[model samples]
Target: MSALERRIEAMRLFGRLVATQEGREYLADNNHKSGQAVVVADYEELIKDVMPRIRSHKPPVTIALLKDDELLMFSIGPTPEAERVSSSAASPESTIGMLYEAACQTSNGSSFHLTSWDRDATAFSMPSVRELLSH
Candidate 1:
C-alpha cells in the first residue's frame, strides 16, 4: 500500500483497538512495554474534537495525545526536521525510539508512556494486537 494508505489503515486499526474495553485495557497494559500512549479519554469525543483541528493543518503533521492525571493533553505540530533526517539514516529503529522519546517529553512530567504511528521502515517491527495479546 501507499504510505498515506498505510497511515490511514494504521489509524483505523488504532480506532478499532480503542473502541473496545478489552482493547483499551490491553493498550494500557502494553503502554509501558510498547511505549505507546493509551487513550484515556472517550475515543468518540477525542475524534470529534481533533478532526476539525487536524483538517486545518498542512501535511506531515504530528499529533500527540498524552494522559496527565485525569486529563488528556493534545500537542499538534509539524513533524520535526529531525524525523525526516533520522529516517534517512541507517537505523530506523533508533529513529522510532527517538520519536517516542520526543513524544514522551510533551507529557510535562506525566508518567504515562507514549507511542507514534508512522508508515516507515520501523512499522515492520511493530507487533500486531493479536501478537501483543498472545504474549
Candidate 2:
C-alpha cells in the first residue's frame, strides 16, 4: 500500500479498536494521573495483534500515532480539516500524550483531539493544542 493507504488502514484499525469495550477499559486502566493514557505499540503490532481482536467497527474516527520524530495521522473516513490543524502543531515527542490528555479532558476516550469525524461536535480544542497541531 502507498503511505496514505497505510495510514488510512492504520486509522481504521485504531478506530475500531477504540470503539471496543476492551479497548476503552485498557485505555482507562493505563491512564495516568495526568489523564494521559500510556499506550505504545509499533505499527506492526497494532495491525497484526490488536486489530484482529476487535469484532466490530463502529463510529469511524481519527487517530494519531507518534514514533520517534514522526507523526502518523489517519482517519476512518475522509480526513477532517481539524486533523490537519492539530497534526501540524504536534511535537513528535508529545503528540501521543497530549492527545491522551485531550481525550480525557473532553471525556472522549478516542482521543478526538488528534483526529475525529468531520462532524463530531465533541472534538477537543485548546489554544495550546491548536498551536501544537499547527506545527
Candidate 3:
C-alpha cells in the first residue's frame, strides 16, 4: 500500500482502538500506574513498523503533528499549504505529545482535544475534536 494508505490505515486502527471502552480503560490504568504516558512511543513504533510498506508503494502524506494549547492536531494531506504551516510552526519533538492528547481524548475518555486538520492549499479545515467535555 502507499504511504498515504498506510497512514490512513494506522489512523483508522487508532481511531477504532481509541473509540473502544477496553482500550480506554487500559490506557488510563497504565497511565495511572506509570505516572507518564507511553502511547506516544507506541504510536511512533507503529508508524515505524508501517513505514517500510508505505514507502515502497508511495510516500506518506506529510502530516504535521501539533499540540495547540490543549489540543492534539495533525495535518491529513500532502498539500504544500499544510506543510508550510506545520514546518513553520510545529517541531517534531512536541508533535508526539499532541497526538497523545488526541488519542487519550478519543479513547472513550472524558475530555476532547481541540484539534484542527487543515487541508493543504484549501480552505477546508478538519477538526479532530469538536467540543470540550468535562469528566
Best by TM-score: 1
Position 54, candidate 3: lDDT:
25
Regions more than 4 Å wrong, model 1: 32-127, 131-135
- Which of the two, 2 or 3, has more lDDT? 2
lDDT of 2 by residue, 1-135 (tens): 444454455455445545666555543443312233222333333222322221133323333444333334322222345644322222234433344344445433232221222232222321112222332
Candidate no. 2 TM-score: 0.27
Name the better of 1 and 3 by TM-score: 1
Residue pairs in candidate 2 whose N, alpha carbon or C atoms collide under 3 angstroms:
86-133, 88-133, 88-134, 88-135, 89-132, 89-133, 89-134, 89-135, 90-132
Which 10 successive residues of model 3 have the least lDDT summed? 117-126
lDDT value, residue 129 of candidate 1: 61
Clashing pairs in 1: 35-114
Give each model a TM-score.
Answer: 0.31, 0.27, 0.25
**Alpha carbon deviation, residue 42, candidate 2 (Å):** 11
Total colliding residue pairs, candidate 1: 1
lDDT of each: 0.35, 0.35, 0.32
Tell me the deviation in Å of residue 40 in model 2.
Answer: 13
Task: List the candidate numbers ranked by TM-score, top first.
Answer: 1, 2, 3
User: Candidate 1 lDDT, tens digit per residue, 23-135?
Assistant: 66765553322333322222222333433444454432333222121112223333344443333222222322243344445332112211232322211111236443322
lDDT of 2 at 127: 15
